[model samples]
Target: MGYKNLKVSIIGIGRVGLPLALFLENLGCKVVGIDKDSEILRDVRKKKMSFDEPGCAALLKKTKMTISPSIQSGVRGSDYIIITVGTPLYNHIESDLSYIKSVCTDLCGSLKGGQTIILRSTVAPGTTSYLKNFVEDNTSLKIGKNFGLAFCPERLAENQAIEELGLLPQIIGTEDNFSKNMTNKLFNLFGVELLFTNYLSAELIKLFNNVHRFTDFAVANQFSVIAEKYNQNIYEIINMANKNYPRGHIPSPGLTAGTCLRKDFGLLNESSSAPDLFLSAWKINEHMPFHLVNSAKKYTKIRGKTIAVLGYGFKKNSDDIRDSLVPKLLRYIEREVPKKVLLCEPNIPKKNIEGFKNTDLNSCLKKADIIFIAINHDAFNKETILGKIKKNAWCVDLWNVLGQKQLVLRYN
Candidate 1:
């Protein structure tokens, strides 16, 4: 089929699926986004993006892609069906496959011969094999002969999804040669390199990639705690160590909880044996907010002080707050019984920061007796924001965005 005639139905037009839909639509594919969220469908109909993703807003404004709430309608005549629904972790640190299971069951009615079903969500190992059997059991279709089934994991970063979708190599994992070739043809339209593997390996690849990053971030967070105990600057020490050495490129410390990093480690450790390294990393990263609050308490009293929390987003410049550590930080701050709390997150929409006393950067900085640069957004420029802060305000900057000598700084 020609690229223009390639009908692609994307289930769950969320952060992952929306970007992919926009990119494929822009790539001359007939794209249709399937989302059960009425709010999301309404926003898509008005050409309004619900989240921050560079390069997708403009494409959404002029795109001809269809957005639908009905799974049957979305999958009726599409050549490719991509599942991008969320697979969140439960409180017990296990992968919750409820969303995935629901989608797969819904898809059985619409699944037909000659159509390729691709699971693009991050799932546990053996999920693809399970899905293949589920579909075969529900319908009379044979996997390799009648329809194609593949596990094509989405490896895009949140803010860079648009750019990375077309640039990053697509990984396709299939059980049969027929499914492999069909998936290859579909993703090859992106003009990126394609790596083909099996279902278990591909699933492990996604989890391993995220777990590696989670552990790497934990190392920095652990060092930050160690440096604070010694009354030394972790950022400065890292810079000194990595200045001329190729082997010593250590990342600086910050709150390191995001949707993928926070949950994927648990997903990997779900079935693994005890003495889990990922769990150790999780402990170190999860304790960062408490560490920040405790570290600040030593120098200044948080009780009855106006405190400003700058930037609530998990990542630096993105507005995605799922699994962000900011909420945990806010909870810690609340326990301290501050006189007033002001939240300032430039990237997040004001509507999203509800139930909190939200304010602009200037006002937040001017009124606060204590400040925490909770997220190191690029907009929190040290040169500019430093001028507006109260001279004697006790600032806790774990990211060290403000070139302060230490984590806790009290400007005179």
Candidate 2:
């Protein structure tokens, strides 16, 4: 089908779905974004973006697609229903499928033949197969005969979704030929490579992509801890090791976390026989905040001092805070009995910040006795941050964004 003739409905128009909705709408597809959140719906109706995604804000203003809070009405006449709802981990590290189950239940009444259902959320293995069976069992439609279902994972990084949506190769996982052909034709419009696989492989592909990066980060974090024990500079070591050697490419350590990396480890190892690898990586990365606090305590006193956390977002250039390590870092700092804690997240809107006072960079720097560069955003560079802070203030920069050459240092 041609882009102009295709009609698509995207469910859960948050980080994942909203970009796809705008991208498809830009392609001349009749797109409808469905979200249960009334606030998100209101923002979309007014062409206001609730979060940050490069190049999406301009597209949002010109987007002519329909956005509504009602799932049934939004998905009624759509040729494709894409589910991008979040699947987070519970406190016990088990995969939570309540969002997926709820979406499927609400979609049962709207289930009809000749419609392609694409799951764009990151999920555990067998989730797509289970959802395929669930849809067939709950509705009168049979897969390949009247209905189509596929698992096409969203692999775009936040803040790069607008560009990557059309650039990255798409992996389509389906059980039958009907879904395979439908999704193939749909994603082919992007003019990128397509890899077709079964439902389980596609699910595993998404999980593995994140788990691999998470484990790599753990290696860097562990190395940083070891370097600190001997008072050696990790930045110097990494720079020497990787400067001219092609085989020596080590990632610098920081607060390694996000909604996907932190949770996907548990999702993959939840049922797999090899759980130790994931558990070890999880421990190493999770211990970073505590390690930073303990290390700072050894250098200078955190008790009754103002502590400033430079960035709250998980990664740089993104405003997504879901599963960010900044909260855990805050909790650890709070236990140190600091008199005040100042938060400065430039990417996140002031209204979205809760339970803490969001201050400007100058205010945070001036008031802070100790500063922790939790995230390495470009705005927190040496020129912007170094000249502003107190000359004698203790700085803990895991990201090494300030060009200090050492993890913890003071100008004096």
Candidate 3:
């Protein structure tokens, strides 16, 4: 069937699911967006989007797709069911499949014989097979012969989700030709390239992609540390290194935030039985927050000091704090530093942090003895507040907002 004629239903209308539904609808497909939360459905109906993804709100308004709170109602009678639910980690960095299982079970009960199920959530290498087994065991329905299954992991940036969805090439995987064709047919409508492979290859592709990023960020962080000891410009050094022929891809230094980098590395390490070199890179990136805290303490006394955190979200131009590095820094400050910590996250709600005063950016900057730029928000580039900061105060540039100042101690 052509993409325009395929009726698609998206489950878990959170970050990735919401945009996917809207993107499919924009392609002239009949799309139904579903989420467990009634409030999220209500928000979508009212054209209220939660994230900073580009073109998402406008797409939601333009598509006018059917939004439903019931998961079963969304999946029934749909040609394709795309799952974009969260796969968060629990204690010891173990993968939690509770949400995935719940959604699969609900779908299996009502799924028709010819429908296809696509898992867009990132999982371990064997997760697709495991889910297939679970679905067959519970519902007594054959997988492949009865219903199709595939994995098409998301590869979009946090802030550029909608644009990336329609622009970036997608990686799809399935066991049979029919399933692969169905997956490719739907994705092709978005005008993005589709690379087809087996299930395991696609799963490893997602993991390896994140691992490469983890290694890059670790190298950048290590270079920054070395440059700080030698009193050199790390950014300049990185630029110079990139000038070499055929051996240049210097990554920028900053706290690697977002849900994928930190958690995917943990998944890779846990899945590996042998000694993996990539795990060390993952450890380096994971320990970055503590490293910044120690560096902050070495330059200035954090005890009894008023520290102002400039940004709380993981990265700039986005307001998602799922696995943000700022909270880790805050916890370390509270444990070691005997001072009051004032947070200045303009995008996130005040209730996210406990016992900390969420003040305006200007107020926090003026009252703070130490300013930590957790995320480089655009509003901070204004010259008035930047000039007003006390010269004696230490500035921890975690995101490299300030280039090179006498009082600035750049962690990235």
Candidate 4:
């Protein structure tokens, strides 16, 4: 039951699982990362990363942990079994619990009596409780008696996963004290404060965090539209309003999206009785992709012009594309039938995105007739972009965050 000499198996070795596995290994635990994607396992074993994140590349290089695709070989006889699979949004918008339930069902087959299984994936409000029942029924073993089950929400942002894992307070809850204590001890090894609560409360905490962030962005996005009507930029206005002003903190307006931000909204809506605000925020964020496309067409016909989407990843320094507005913007622009579309995301590898000409910053700057700054990566400066872009070529700064945070509202 002690931290050292513990065996931890993390199911689903994507962004969340990989870092968690590495952290556990750093804590002197023997870690095994199991995923069905052989490509991910190959990249991980070879120290070749599929995407870029803060502190991920260096950590992957030095990791001596076991990574495999076979669940029996990876998870069997483990002291702790952790599920970090996704609850992705499907049909454009709805909680698809396929991955979570599938992972749980598979995990039940590999469960060792007395081993602890932690739910670290974001889920609907009652999912943690439901998992306890599902595992008991499937395994024919009592959850609290035969094994420990805890819902420990994974709260780290993609780019800041490593730092935040140690810095941010972790939320964990279980039916019995044994699982609760085990989760706390495990997270404590990561150098974080444990915020213990009930199972459903912990699950809701994760969903609520995602809901609030997107809703706040929706408010900022609405302000952006209103500012445009008055020949003003909302980013500047928000900055000016928040200048040393108490209770004036507001997130900047931009492409409001991400896998968690948009997907969790569906889970929130399904779980909550009053989902009006959540639904509204989703609608507003959903409209933003088409909004950028329509705004860009106001300049010239795109039928034969080459368009360069400067950044397509969900956010700056992130390679996750789940529910990102950049792809939606691309889909909408495809209807406009541009001569060609070039995706210019230096952080994202070319293999992740298909069909589009994924090129470097230099090539995109030279070839584009219309340039849309979809994401505000640190590398792109407004002056530097202006220096690179062809004069008289249209620039549609959707995030309005090229050289600076404010986008000039005057679009002509």
What's the C-alpha lDDT at position 391 in model 3?
A: 59
Model 1 agreement with the true structure over 270-373: per-residue lDDT tens digits: 88778778889999999999999999999999999999999888889988888889889989999999999999988976744857756889999899999999
lDDT of each: 0.90, 0.89, 0.79, 0.80
Query: For candidate 2, lDDT tens digit of each residue in 1-412?
Result: 6666689999999999999999988887889999999999999999999998889999999998888787778889788999999999888778998999999888888887899999999998888987888888899999988889999999999988989989999999998999988888788777789999999999999999999999999999999999999999999999998999999989999898998999998888787666598899999999999998988888899999999998988899778888889999999999989999999999987844769877888998888999999999987998888878976899999988988787778765
Highest TM-score: which candidate? 1
Candidate 3 runs further than 4 Å off: 1-3, 229-232, 243-246, 349-355, 382-385, 405-412
Better of 1 and 3 by lDDT: 1
For every candidate structure, what is the RMSD over all alpha carbons to the true structure, in angstroms?
1.2, 1.4, 2.7, 2.4
Candidate 1: deviation at residue 59, Å?
A: 0.5
Candidate 4 regions exceeding 4 Å error are 272-275, 299-303, 403-412
In the predicted model 3, the residue pairs found to clash are none
- Per-residue lDDT, model 3, residue 37, is 86
**lDDT (tens digit, per residue) of candidate 3 on 1-412:** 6548789999888988898888888788888999888888888888988666778878876777888877788777889999988887777757887888898778867888888889999987788988888888887667667778899999887778777887888899899876877777788787888888888899889988987888888888877777877878777787688886478887877787678887887666676676666767766676777777787877778889888887777878567878888888888878875567888878765554546666888887777888877777876653635676765777877555665532255222
Off by more than 4 A, model 2: 1-3, 273-275
lDDT of 1: 0.90
Models ranked on lDDT: 1, 2, 4, 3
Q: For model 2, state the Cα shift of residue 397 in Å.
A: 0.7
User: TM-score per candidate, in order?
Assistant: 0.98, 0.97, 0.92, 0.92
